[model samples]
Target: MKLEDLRGRLMAVDKKFKEMYEGLERNKIKSIIYDKMGKPVSLKKLSGYEIENITEKRGIVGVDGSINSYGGIYPHYISLIQSMAKSTLPKEEDIILQDVYVPLFEDEDGQAEDELKRRARMSKLELQAASFAMESFSSKVIFMDGSLMHYGIDCPSEWKKFKEKAISTGKIIIGITEEVKTKDIAEILKTELNLNDSILYDREVLFGILNEGEMLEFRRDLKSKKSESGIKSCYVRLSEDPQVAGLDFIEEQYVEALKYADLIYTLTPEKGRGIPLWLDIVDKEVKVTDEMVKSLVESTISREIREMLLNPKRSKRG
Candidate 1:
């Protein structure tokens, strides 16, 4: 295509975007949400006195994980997966748990099942690390870096045990999602209004609909043929930025979600995106970088074995 044709296409795309942007009414969407769900939950700033009261018994902890593959394809791949749980208490130490997945060692069906296996393995490791954190630390609040419902889907057995531990120990566990991805609200709206407009996701709908420190009360149900999970989830604007974040809580402790939300909002930076600083620290500690993968594979595996079993032909070409 010539330059003029490309310029014409770009102009058409810009015009279509403006049309869509003009059609959005955030307040109206917010009203529709309240009709389907309940009223919004108001989140107030935590005063020094309030913080002291909440943390008097125990400090908060954050749990996060990393998953990566070092080799080329199929049975030749070696995945490094680990999860870390860190506490805010000065005396407490980080708990790190690791897992290694080699398709050669397992009875995996095919290449198509690789990602699902990786996710399930990562969830298992994360839940185990969380269990350790709850048992070992003096923390009343435990924050997981991603969706709570995800683990339930990936590793249901381990996920149940983790939730049981949380309930038995009287700990508040909340999942913090940097990116929200769910379409229940869209489905509701489409059915109620009887129209198909091709635009209704919780993330896009809640963009600027919520005020800073305010949470849109919601119930996100995870339904599958094998199992069903009913976790309470909400979109909270922790900072002044228009971008919203997702907070998921187990059904057992969702009644006290407000109390936990205050602590989370307090720890998040007022000027930045809405994620707790503790979770960021845990993520940094648990991340499996390329260099770390390289070092682990090179140090542990014999060169002859690596070349015969795990090494890719692309490495030699490069």
Candidate 2:
């Protein structure tokens, strides 16, 4: 393409973007706010006294995991590790409960492949860890790094069991996700208000509406077979960070959920990353670096097996 043509195309896109930006700015005048339960709600900026210097008797647990795979071997293998922290102790001294599993696949089915196997294994490990945390640390809040909803379709029974156990034990389970793609709010606006903006995501819309220390709770529909047992979710902004995160918890524990959110805000650093500090600590502890994987394989497997497992195409280059 000629340079002139390229410049002309770029200018056309820029003009279109400016027009859309103006449209969004005008649309905000008629924007509607709704809670998780689809009821109309008003947004209030939380006061300093409401969130500052808050104290509670409940303990907090943060859970996160890592997964790595080696693909060239006969039985493709993945190393899965989950780390849970009961307290905000230093990373070195923290009594983090860890569960590690290496699943080897010998079948031709894709279910045994790295991605699917990793999701399944992580889901099982997280459920077990949440249960253990609740039973072991009574009345404490259990924080999982992602949605309580199981990602794989094959694990509905396990997922339902976890939710039932959590409800029966009266344990508070909070799932914090850094990124979200749910279109619940957008859909509500389009269907109910007759407003449509396909380009904006839930987070992007909420990002402009919510102030720091405020959250918008929405009731999710549980009638869907894949819903996470009627869990309620909220979009929260803990700090001055422009990004908003999704927080999911059981509907029965609404007050406790807000308390957990305040606690998370307190732990969040002013100038640090948007996530709670405790979550960052647990994530660092659980992350499986490439060097760690290499060390583990070298220390455990024989050199003959390692050489044989190395991808032949890569081996030939040497």
Candidate 3:
């Protein structure tokens, strides 16, 4: 396409966006009037709580893993490295956990070629580790790195059992996601409230709707076909970066959910990007570097086997 054509398309999109913004404003006014009638409101401003008021016990645990596969040889192999961080606050201390698993590919019925199994193994490990921490600690809040909703239809019973155990222990399991794709709230606004133009992702619609240290709760119906996990979520803005994140918690734990959100906001640095420092520490501990992979392969494999391994032409040239 020519540069002039691209420029024209960009200008058209800008005009469309302006029209959509005006429509949204009009819908907000209608929503306010409807809210006064005591109807079901999807979004509301949160007040009466400040970040300085957050003084609760928090025990945060994060799990992440890395995988590397070598498929060029006769016997394929994969190296999986997993790490977990357990942190207790008020007096911050982190206990690090690490493990490595090496699986040899047998090529039996093509099962060895499936990558999803590897991913599932990592997920299962992470969940189990987090569950153990939840059971061992008496902290009011327990944190995880991703969604608590298990989307895998084929997930094992143990995975569900661990989550149940954590919740049954009366500790709040909070999942903080940097990126979210859920459209449940947006769908609710369109279907129940008859707002047609608000068909964007939940985060996009809530981009600037929340102020710093404020969170908007979203309740999902367990019987709704769209809600597979029956989990309740909220959108929170932790800093002044104009970025919002989705926080998922169990539906029955509404009051605890609000407190957990405030605690996260309190821990978030005011000057840096909006994320808790403990999460950052765990993320760095679990990340796998290329040098680490090279060292693992060199130290584990014999020199003869290393030479027998195949290398791509470009890698060999370098």
Query: What tens-digit string does per-residue lDDT give for candidate 2 at 1-318?
Result: 469989999999999767544534424423455433433233343355643333233446777766664435434444645555455323323334444444443345554464575577767766666667666663357778876555334367776777777778767778888776776665654554444654655665565566666676554442322244566777777667867777777666766666667676666765665667778877887777778777777777777866655434554574
The per-model lDDT (C-alpha) reads 0.82, 0.61, 0.58
lDDT order of candidates, top first = 1, 2, 3
**Which tens-of-lDDT digit does each residue in 1-318 have in candidate 1?**
469989999999999777655545667777887876646778877887887788775788999999887877888979999999898887998899999988888786888687788889999998888899888999888899988989878998889888988888888889999888877666665566553665666677678888888887753343322123657777789988888898888878888755788888888998877898889888888999999999999999888988888878988995
Q: lDDT per residue, candidate 3, 194-271, as tens digits?
A: 667555665565566556766655443323332445466666677776677767776666556656565676667766
Query: Which candidate wins on lDDT?
Result: 1
User: Candidate 2: which stretches are off by over 4 Å?
Assistant: 1-23, 26-30, 34-58, 71-77, 89-106, 111-114, 151-154, 190-200, 219-228, 310-312, 315-318
State the lDDT at 268 in candidate 3: 70
Question: What TM-score does structure 2 among the candidates reach?
Answer: 0.75
Q: Lowest summed-lDDT stretch of 10 residues in model 3?
A: 37-46
lDDT of 1 at 90: 78
